[model samples]
Target: MKIILNGKEKEVADSTTLQLLLQAMQLHPEMVACELNLNIIKRNKYGSTQLGEGDCVEILQMIGGG
Candidate 1:
């Protein structure tokens, strides 16, 4: 399936969940915020949020500098 990830088109496996996608991308779930199709998805719901074709996903990671 094809989806828009961070404004870029990408292909992912069928029935992919947000959690799985993050893991595949090697991202730390605790450090990032995810938005699906313009809607913010709760961290706890990542495992249940299924991704579909044409879905728009935005992943923002937190960084700290002092």
Candidate 2:
């Protein structure tokens, strides 16, 4: 299946959940914010949110500085 991640198209396995996608990308959900198809997904729902073909995801990380 193909999904749009961070504005780029990528192929991912079927039945991929937000949690699994984060793991595959080596990202920690606790340290970042995620938006699926322009809608924000709460951290508590990552495990239950299923990603599918044509879906779009935007992930942003929180950084502290200055």
TM per prediction: 0.92, 0.91
The number of clashing residue pairs in model 2 is 0
Error of 1 at 10 (Å): 0.4
Cα error, candidate 2, residue 59 (Å) = 0.5
- Residue-level lDDT tens digits of model 2 in 4-25: 9999999999999999999999
lDDT, model 1: 0.96
Candidate 1 regions off by >4 Å?
A: 64-66
User: Any residue pairs clashing in model 2, and if so which?
Assistant: none
Angstrom error of the Cα, residue 36, model 1: value is 0.3
Quantify how close model 1 is to the true structure by its C-alpha RMSD in Å. 1.5
Clashes of each: 0, 0
Candidate 1 on 1-66: residue-level lDDT in tens? 999999999999999999999999999899899999999999999999999989999999867878
